[model samples]
Target chain A: MAPVVERAREVRYATAAELPEAIVGADVLFAYDFFSSAIPDAWPAADALEWIHVASTGVDAILSPELRASDVVLTNSRGVFDEAIAEYVLGQVLSFAKDLPRSWELQQARRWVHRESERVAGTSALVIGTGQIGRAIARLLRAAGIRVSGSGRRARTDDPDFGTVTAQEDLHEALAGADWVVCIAPLTEATRGMLDGAAFRAMADHARLINVGRGESVVTDDLVTALREGAIAGAALDVLDTEPLPDDHPLWDLPDVRITPHNSGDFVGWRDALVRVFTDNFARWVDEEPLRDVVDTSLGYVPTDGSAR
Target chain B: MAPVVERAREVRYATAAELPEAIVGADVLFAYDFFSSAIPDAWPAADALEWIHVASTGVDAILSPELRASDVVLTNSRGVFDEAIAEYVLGQVLSFAKDLPRSWELQQARRWVHRESERVAGTSALVIGTGQIGRAIARLLRAAGIRVSGSGRRARTDDPDFGTVTAQEDLHEALAGADWVVCIAPLTEATRGMLDGAAFRAMADHARLINVGRGESVVTDDLVTALREGAIAGAALDVLDTEPLPDDHPLWDLPDVRITPHNSGDFVGWRDALVRVFTDNFARWVDEEPLRDVVDTSLGYVPTDGSAR
Candidate 1:
């Protein structure tokens, strides 16, 4: 569908400091940092607010309850971060299989230690949330000869690359055979504690976990307990419920855990990607085409929204 | 032509030390540790010595000059180590791109850091040799969306997966566009010191080098100079001119360089892989089919001997 074209007036900028005049009369709302205390709680229902675009994939913070409840079309920068985070996941999987960290320590000691490594081929991977990021990972892993299974809130029989896909209720069955379990689900109320002790126990003994999604989805205490007891192989985490993880957190000392400070999808060109995503969304909204990455306020997810189809 | 096989009426054990008289007349030979004193300098010219196979890919030390010049056909275990070493290369590539070593150090200090990382997609890789291991690396890199090129003694046009394959003479040209330069070529008289300052200078500034083939193939001093000057982004080395890279070596202090003690392919199942290859070759010999991986006595590389084909 061709987008509805709204006439352009002067481009209004919300500089995050001084509010650029009331955008009620403007045709577009470029909300970069409005969620961070810069935006007024309420505004007049104006022409400027016809299309609201967020810089982040998750619109929970940016969308005031009323904004989401309103008719203003909302879109997000969702696809921008997939390649970066998927690459991060692949890197973590390789590091774990090849024992690169241990090799580095041995190198430091000038020792010729030989360690056996597992091949990714013939291994099974369980990907939670068959979103853009998860789909991209499935394609890449499938190319490498891995068997990938995807899990989301509902079964997706259309995604053929993932051999066995199921809804949230079947997560346990999915994890039973996976050698690598990737968590990329957003933090919805239902998913907040989805990966708790029970989930951990379902994973294979040699399974490795990677979280580039919402940290709250995984119960940190359960993860630590699993790692300490050797219930699972290891983990590589780029997200946490708390930013700047506390220095005294026991997770820091977990023997097989790898931690990154919430930077999985951030890269050199990420800002440019973010800008591109927003610019395209703006164009789509201006032309009145169904907006891409439209969030389902009720479900709290950027819906499939027919964009993928 | 099938491999020549003979029956053993009597067998002798050199490493086992207890030679049985019942095996003295054995026509077939299985010499393990037979060279504890000295490798037999003279070819025995035993009528039963129709086939000789070495467990190692490199038979330089195993084959005495006489054995190499002998009339008996011989083969070496060439395919055994390829997969294991290719797995190692994948590890190094992932580690470098993910900033894994730095992350590990930070984790140890309980410091949370978020660093920019690289994606493997759309990058160019240069494999210096187009042998079993190099081909394996190419397959993995291709699966990861990297443009792969290779250099071999002879360039064949049929291998279209290689973006820009070339003959050995064009290696410098191949290195120019490479984001990753992997060396897995055999160590031959002509290949020794092949990777020097001049070669490193030709590589892109952000490119990484991984040497898993042979230590003698790289000039350590030149490599160190190139790395120190930032001629290339970094290096992940599994082999060095000297094994167990001396404690005081300057390369150890370079933060950008990752060192391993020549242990790229020594995995748990390596011995079994060698035995399997050997057994297959023996079976082939018994069938009077052409032997595989026969070395050219004159060139020290398999297949340089035109008679093998």
Candidate 2:
């Protein structure tokens, strides 16, 4: 970013308010803050805007009818978060399977209690997205000997990463059979609030949910009701609908829920890695070469050929 | 055991005290409580004993000079614990690399702080045993892309699971290069109190130790001091120098130390699995077939050809 700022002939910086004026004649708009949702507000002033490069995965925040209809090619930082997020999801899975939370409590009480733990090798997991991040999660969990399938936009079989890809419409059927459910779908028209009461009821009572995707993908109220009613055994959420979840939030004191701030894909050097992705994509745009991680505005994600890697 | 007991003409069950009299007319002895030291004391009365089977791994507790010098064949439940223990160790490794303990602390207080986690894929681990359980750990960690090596009784290259197995004498040199040092070695004359002050000092300050081996494998005081001075970053002990560690013990509340009762290899059906192991070996012994999991008493564990599977 320092090098790009130094080398450019003209560079304009703006907050959400100033973005309208600052974007007046810009050929390239770099949405450094991907979550700000400022791009659409300034879309009318982007007279020369040829492209918009977001610094994070999930371009839902910036996507709108005007931008999607316009010819502004959009690219996202995809690869940077794959491995880190995959590791996080696997860690959360193991935490529940091994009863690590109870162990922590016992350790605090100086209690030496022995309990039998469970194994993931023979368990089944259903990943709710088929994008890069979801594929990464599938690969990692499969590596641990867990059976992995996907609930994607369409149903298919013999996928490279997820052997069986069930269409989103069949999510309930898939949920009923899985021991673990992971949500990594983007916040989109059909995806938002997908995990409601019905979905929870569809899951086995011993099943657990791990959400590293958008918080809105799950219905918060339904999740609370499900937890209270013992619809699911536990949940480990990295993303929550109401983040920094209010201190009085009941999920905080729930019997078997684990919460962490939304930093799942963030590992040391991630910022540099994201910058490198942006710079590399920028160079490709400048050279008129094919860009990587190009998001199809209509599809809302970078489509894959049924292969995880 | 029920089926066997129902058919036998002279079925005998005994407490440790009665074990001496029980041994007077026994042809085969099954040491159900593996940790009991009654075998050596009962050895003098074992006039007809031909085989002894222990319902656990780690024959160290029951191994005695008299029994070793006797003609009685020693067999242990070895294969039962491999995969279960491997899963536990990997879960523990992820727990550390992902900062789960601190996440638990933050979650309890309803804090939403974001912090970067670490990946084990590119890091290195040194497993301090080359037996079945240790090799299982090596295979699992290596699958996650960690560079896995071994420290055993001998130094060799091209070993199946661990590419290069360092000799036990060079443990200090090996410890210096490892980010995670896992001890799964059995307690033997050479291994007892092996991880002392010099060993901890030899490890990098950022390195962490995980002991799933034996309580006596590490010197507790030295480990406490090492953790205090940051000689090593942290530790996760499934087996400590003292079981049910004393309430006032300083190690209990140490900043980064996590303690769990010694149940790393025990899973939901582990007791049944152990019984199956013993029963299967008994059937083989009665038929005069070569015993399975035969402990080379002098070597102190079941020797492997180095293949993890």
Q: Report the number of the highest-DockQ candidate.
A: 2
Which RMSD values do the candidates have, in order?
4.9, 1.8
Q: Whose lDDT is greatest here?
A: 2
- Itemize residue pairs with steric clashes in candidate 2: none
Report how far residue A92 has shifted in candidate 1, in Å: 0.6
**Candidate 1 DockQ score?**
0.57
Q: Put down candidate 1 lDDT per residue, A98-175, tens digits, no spaces.
A: 777887777667667756766666888999988777877788778767788899877877766565679999888888
Ten residues in a row with the worst lDDT in model 1 chain B?
Answer: B1-10
TM-score of each: 0.87, 0.96
Cα misplacement distance, residue A109 of candidate 2 (Å): 0.4
Error of 2 at B235 (Å): 0.4
Report the C-alpha displacement of residue B49, candidate 2, in angstroms.
2.1
Where is model 2 chain A poorest over a 10-residue stretch in terms of lDDT?
A1-10
DockQ-derived CAPRI band for the predicted complex in model 1: medium
The sequence of per-residue lDDT tens digits that candidate 2 reaches over residues A183-265 is: 99988889999999999999999999999998899998899999999999988898888777888989888988988888888
lDDT of 1 by residue, B66-142 (tens): 66677756566776676667767877887788788888889889999778877778888899877667777888888
